[model samples]
Target: MVNRFKDPSAHLEIADLFAEHDRSSLPIELGVSRRTLFRYRDLYVHLIETDEELMPNLNAARQDPHFQKINERLGHLLDRYDSKWTEMEDSRAEAFYDWVPEHRR
Candidate 1:
């Protein structure tokens, strides 16, 4: 029975359907026992988490085009700010060194 659902999408769809329907009637509709349905659901979630092909689909937020654009823009902004931060730190260090007395050095 498990072998029949080799495709990750099928596994996910059936599992989601079972989740939405009454647990007692699920076996009647799916032609499998409740325990088997639970097992399949667990298997499907595991595949979604670990399988390379299905893993990307699990991240709903990252799948959004708007979110992707925002993420890219934020990355660029961080890169620009990081360079300025590094320059500021370097200048502060130089100023600290110059302020130190020769005797203290």
Candidate 2:
């Protein structure tokens, strides 16, 4: 899936809002419950932290039976929320750019 938003920053905002789960006082209504969001978030964190190779090669991982379930779940959520995993990844890179020293950026 591809992010259709015109503004580049919208990617990060969408990712943040979609991943917010139950943390926000002002909640956004989405297709999935907060519990589902939290569960998927935890899974995403664990997957990225533990699988270094997978992060750089999600397309390949998506084809493997071991990772197919995650890919399907992510695709389902992305479809429901109108997002792409690549957009979430782009948001991570954007955040990293902000985290580094000003000179580095």
lDDT of 2 by residue, 1-105 (tens): 122333333444445544542254222221212322122331222112221332345443345553454344444434323444434445332123325578986
lDDT for each of the candidates? 0.35, 0.35
Runs of candidate 1 with Cα error greater than 4 angstroms are: 23-33, 38-105
lDDT of 1: 0.35
lDDT (Cα, tens digit) per residue for candidate 1, span 4-104: 23343454455444354424432243333333332342232211111133223424445555445544543332222124453212222111333657899
| Ten-residue region with minimum lDDT total, candidate 2 | 42-51
- How far out, in Å, is residue 50 in model 1? 31
* Candidate that would win on lDDT: 2
